[model samples]
Target: MNRESGRYKGKRIIQGGRTQVRTVLYMAMMSAMQSNPIFKATYQRLLEAGKPKKVAIIACVRKMVVILNSMLRDGTMWDENMAKN
Candidate 1:
């Protein structure tokens, strides 16, 4: 949380990470939301659950990051069934 002028703010994403990587991931998420069924379904579910648009997009970003990291660590190709698990 951030405190300024005696007012407490909601928790926010820290800004210390690599901005370029973040930017690329965010853009990729946007495209994925359109073309990838998994991402598209997740994004739609979040929105249907009453999350704000930006919040849903950010959630997609986090999901994408996790999926990418796991794929890299395991050296596995993209698999829709694997993602379901």
Candidate 2:
């Protein structure tokens, strides 16, 4: 496991390792929101800005992945509040 940005790159979530890919993805995103601080903050911010919860959650997941990519490339940990400007 490559530990770039405090995230396990090349990570995999096994759903029997072969089933329900979309469901697994959605659940994984929800889990990330619940456990990852950056994701949680983004999700809440979206909600506060009048985005629907489902839309916000999806956006959060997309943001999370983008951040992960950036961190992996730059070798940095997830920042809790870096974009508050």
Candidate 3:
């Protein structure tokens, strides 16, 4: 998953989005980091596997976006642990 996109141009990790939509997406990414076990585990695993810390975080954000998009498209509730595998 690639979180580093033109859509996120000029946006820093500490300084997130501009519009409400981007802000919401940024907040969701942060929430996925803090509260989602699967995301947390994936992050830790990536870090342990020698991926850069920032890179891992970005990957997490990208994965979160994909999952959120899928849920909204399918009209399904989020199951936070679904990505644990």
TM-score of each: 0.77, 0.56, 0.62
User: Given candidate 2, what's the lDDT at residue 76?
Assistant: 88
**Sort order, lDDT high to low:** 1, 3, 2
Give residue 76's error in model 3 in angstroms: 0.3
Which clashing pairs does model 3 show?
Answer: none
Higher-scoring candidate on TM-score, 1 or 2: 1
Worst 10 residues of 2 by lDDT: 10-19
Clashes of each: 0, 0, 0
Q: Tell me the whole-model lDDT of each prediction, alpha carbons only.
A: 0.84, 0.69, 0.74
In terms of lDDT, which candidate is strongest? Answer: 1
lDDT of 1 by residue, 26-64 (tens): 888899999999999999999999998877988999987
Q: What is the C-alpha RMSD of each candidate to the true structure, in Å?
A: 2.7, 13.3, 6.9
Clash count for candidate 2 is 0
Error of 3 at 52 (Å): 0.8
1-85 in candidate 2: lDDT tens per residue?
2334655465323235435765666688899878877678788989999987777876766676677688899888867664322
Candidate 3 residue spans exceeding 4 A from truth:
1-27
Judge candidate 2 at residue 33 and give its lDDT.
Answer: 78
